[model samples]
Target: MNDALEIDDLTLWLGMLEKVVDGSTNMVVVTDRERRIKWVNATYSRVTGWSLPECIGKRPRELLHGPQTSAEELSRLASLIRQGQSVSNFELVNHKKSGEPYHVALNIEPIRDAHGEVCAYLSIQSDITERRQQERHTVELKQRLEVAQRLARLGRIDTEVETGRPRWSSEVFRILGMVPDEAPREFEGLLAFTVPEDVSDLRRSLADGVEAGEELDVEFRVIGRHGQQRWVRCRGVPACEDGRYTLPRSWSVQDITFYKMRLEEKRQRNEELNQLVLARTRKLEESNRALEEFSCALSHDLRSPLRHVAGFAHLIKENLAKGSVDDCLGFCDRIVQAAGRMQNLIEGLLSFSRMGREGLNVERVDLDAMLREVVVGLHDDAGLRNIQWRIAPDLPAIQGDAVLLREVWINLLDNALKYTGHRDISEVEIGWHPHPDGPVFFVRDNGIGFDPEHAQKLFGMFQRLHSEPQFKGDGIGLALVRRIVESHGGRIWATSKLNQGATFYFLLPNIADSAMPSDWGAVESVHAIGCRCGDSQAVEPGLQS
Candidate 1:
């Protein structure tokens, strides 16, 4: 009777355990030490679509995995289980009875007998496909967000409030031309990268925000590794804890280099254009006033002399026909000569005025040939008086108006010859040299030079350095040369020492050629001049005699 009661109580306990295992949602299976299935719950059959009869005498591998399962994983699992160890929450893929793949989170535990010998293995598996998919989606979204930030020229930085530790994103390191490992570790170290002019302001702003727990929006400049400065705008939000800021605060910095550059360029261009327009308006008003004065001078001063010459010449012809004396003949000759001088002066003035108003027809001209012709013409002139001329060989061709440029050469060569008429052997040298930026052409003369202080007025309209008796010129030649050279985008200046010599130099910019580093410095100097061609102050006065 005692043996029967023991067997019956054991049956009742086994039945209750089986009922609990079958009703659970997790699939449970028991395997022998050799990994052969010994017992399986009803939930296992429902989940795997395999009945007890089919799985009873089979190993777990045969019932769960086919050729697609990893042999290495199977070897590892067996090795662990034989050592009396268990693995929990391990992931695996297995095929159901219908050949459909399912992902599971598996937990395997060792079952031991009373003699402390491992007899079976208990495994519980739960479906985890949806959970794994959600995790993957979260990771993909984070990667996309980082990409968007990089495209926007933005970066994020985090700092520990208490320890002053700093961390920068990959984009931040890229913007600063630094690697993450090479970046600064502390907030002060990072702030050192900011330009010295901006560092104090940045520190003040950041401190204010941290102390008061307020949000910050600040713009500052930083010198990058390439020595190029860039502008950045940073916005930060502080995380507070009990009136004190702790860790986990972040700020976003965006590169505003392009925006700042555009604004500065626009402002500069507007100012330049405004100045140009104002200067042009002033020039037009002066020209109009000069024209009015010339009209009045022409009608009164010039016409009176012409009328006297014409009236006297007719009287001389009539007196000759009526046997007039020698006195009448001498008076006629004086009137005619005075009128001729007036005519010459009027014509010269008209030509000078027309030079600035006319447009040039630009073309490539052989400067050597042009200078040869000018020298030949000066040699033939009656007033050229023992002049010695030197012209360079193989001078390069220049893009200019032939007619206008010829006029320039004529005026310069004529001045050299006429001014040095009193000298024993008047020397004039005309040549060109190639500069790193462009070409520099010069005309030097050993003549009666003027004071260096008056060099600024040499190229002004109607400016005369010499007295009328000493150098008899209309004083419009140099001004005309200036207008012509400047109209072709060139510059002109004179260097002289009194009683020694004078050298007039001019530069043509590289309009269709590559600019060198030397060009930058020269261009800076060129822009410093307020006037484009002739002296701004000299345009108002009438031409000196």
Candidate 2:
């Protein structure tokens, strides 16, 4: 009878609380210290499809959360309530009794007893399923807009109508040759980069557009980063408040440099075709001058090697006449070495001639394994044993001739080793620099480097920066490297400080030989290596047969 009376009293109190919580939209829950649900507002039954008696003894998570609910948020909620504190704006994913997922923001507080001890926890849950979905949709649209602008080669800028101070998109900054997120400077400061002839007209058009609330469009030239000339087109559309108070005007800028360049090239080509007959005489004269330079360089370089063979041959004859067998053998060795030097030079010349006349035998080349083989061959040399070698992994594969590309690595690595022979602990690194143009391969070595002033001469035939005895070469190796790289539509250069390390860089397109360099198949290619006649030099010491 007493249990029956207690049940009657509890039912009466629940009815009163339901009337108090009438029209409240939040799903309110009350759980004891053991997390058994003691009471739930009518909103919880309406939202979850569970009646008061059905959820009277269940934990909230078991009824409303599943695999997708955030474990972190649940842990945080438990910690806050156990510490007799309140947690607001905590987000969690929950499910209805139908197993449909929804998002909720929880505001929870711990209910205290008379002695300040925790008794039950009260949680107010606000459903935010639609709001979270809207936020995700907004992000997706923003991303699509950015991609579209980039693909159109267009960028936007907004400028205050009176001051002309600008706010730019990332692409706008790129179009203007400024770094993204860079600090802003005065708008007039940019005029210094604009071509003087076009600046006044461009400014006048923009100012006129702002004053009259008219559309503006113009094209102008400006000096870009690194002093490169670029042409850009700007179109402006203005916005106003109350049809009179002008605000920031939106400007669309496009990089039209390539289009202008194409027009100029088409015109020049037309003129070239019409004047072919007149250009022939000038071409022949230029050809004649180039041939003389090539002949001079070959004659000068060959003379020294040939003279060594002749002079040593005569010395051998003298030693025989004196009946000195030991001296004669030594002179014979020197004669053979000089002959071998001459043979290598002739071979290089023949190879270059063939490279010019023949089309590339292009094929896929696996660079990483091939370089491993190249490094192994270099390690076979006793002189390079003490050097530290670093080869970057996962070098990209390129399509080119196996023979020519192999030669590229051989010449570069050989030069690195030769130049670094002086250091007690030599170091050489082979890596690549990737950019929008293509991959740039570099061979860096800690060596006795050359003076920067003579860098331009390093790739010329028989050009030696050091003395004859200090470093030995006909100076043909790097010239050979330059020849092969240019043939593959690539460029080669070097940088160094004296006595410090040097890095030699060569950039090759992804598919080499796809677009050959100018004068690619020229018959008289020897002129590419022609330079002032200098003393005859041999290959690196110990390179003789």
Candidate 3:
């Protein structure tokens, strides 16, 4: 009776095992020692589209393996099974009865009898095709994100405040001029890379943002490991959990050195443009003042010469009417003298007007040669006076209009000769010195000079520091000299004190440095050096006499 009960109990146990296998979500297969399919649960048939009867005599590999399956994996699985070894989670591509491929993660165990020999093999598998696809998609997305960051010159950082641990992405390491393994553990350590001038501000921004749990935005400079200075814009926000600040704070950083350089260039250009406008405005104001002065000169100065002629002619008429023959001849001589004076005045005005309207014919002009020519022309005017011309041997050749430049030398030298009329021995020195921006030329004279206060007014049209009786001039020579100098992109100024010698200075750029503008109407292209007259401090020692 005990033997009969054991048989019934075994049958009940077998039935229970079969029911459990069929009810399972995982596909299960039981194979004999020969690797042939002995039995398969309902899930196996439902998953592979093959019934138990059709799969009973066939091997699992023969029914499920497809062209997409890995041959090496199948070989390894077979070798392990022959050794009676169990394999877990062996993944491979498997095909269904309908010829569709799917991914499978398989687990197999060796079933042994009481003799300790393998009798059959049990296999369990789970369909994981969707899970594998999801994992692959996640990896592809991460790769794309990294590529995007690199292209944008952008980097990312994550820091846990509580642990003081920081995580840097590969791009962040590159931006900081370091390798990934060299990333700082604490965020504060990153401050070492910041430039000294910007470090304090960056530190304050970080501290305030972290303390208040607010968004952080700042632009600062960083000196990388390679010692390259670059600008970077950083933005970050603290992570929140349950309405409270969490540990990790995230940030995005981007290199902005190129943008900053472009902005600086733009700002410089704007400043230059503004200066040009102001210079043009000043030139206009000067021109207007000159115009008003010219009108006054015409009405007052020219009219005086005309009135003198009319009065002299009337006196001569009265002398003739009174039959005073000798007195009439004297009146006639005075009228002739007045007419000559008026002619000189008209000629001076014509020359001054021409200086403004004429365009410059710029070329290399030898001042040494030009000076000798001017001195030779003044021989008759110098007469028997003991005059000495101390011309510097090393006078530079400059780029300017030859005709206008010669006029400059003539006017200056003539004035020197005229002012030194009272001197027993007249000395005129013309010399030049090298300057960093250009060459400076000066004419020093031992002549009776005017007050230093009137130096600036000496350049105005028809502005004469001396009266006609004091100096025989039409008050236009110096003004013409100034116009010619300015048109050639040079500057002229004089310094003097009463009864002392006067010195006139002018600067002309070298040929290589000359950047004469095509339009000289506004005269705005000239470089402005300090034009303060009588300011000994403004004059360089080399420029001093």
Best by lDDT: 3
Task: For residues 1-545, write the lDDT of model 1, one tens digit per residue.
Answer: 22323433433544565777888888888676777776678888998999877887698778788656677877787777778988788777777898777778879988666556675677888877678778889889978878988888788787656666677777776677776673435434445679898888788888887777777788888887777778878887777888787333577878888889999999999999999999899879868865764675576556766777888887788888899777696877879776776876687678767765778787777777888987887788746377777665556677778898888888887877776777899888776555644566667777887787998788765578998657876556787788778778777777667776666777665533422223454433332331222223311122111
The TM-score values for the models, in the order shown, are 0.56, 0.44, 0.73
Task: Tell me which of candidates 2 and 3 scores higher on TM-score.
Answer: 3
User: On residues 13-106, what C-alpha lDDT tens digit does candidate 2 reach at each position?
Assistant: 4466567764689888877767788888888888888888999999987798887888897898778776778888899999898998889998
Candidate 3: tens digits of C-alpha lDDT, residues 340-400: 8888878877777776567889888877788888988886678899998776563557788
- lDDT-best of 2 and 3: 3
Candidate 3: which stretches are off by over 4 Å? 1-18, 159-166, 182-184, 239-248, 268-364, 380-401, 417-452, 468-472, 486-491, 495-503, 507-545
How far residue 45's Cα lies from its native spot in candidate 2, in Å, is 3.6
Instruction: Write down the lDDT of every candidate, Cα atoms only.
Output: 0.72, 0.72, 0.77
Q: Whole-model lDDT for model 3 versus the true structure?
A: 0.77
Per-candidate RMSD, Å: 10.9, 26.0, 8.7
State in Å the error of residue 340, model 1. 12
Worst 10 residues of 2 by lDDT: 531-540
As a TM-score, model 1 comes out at 0.56
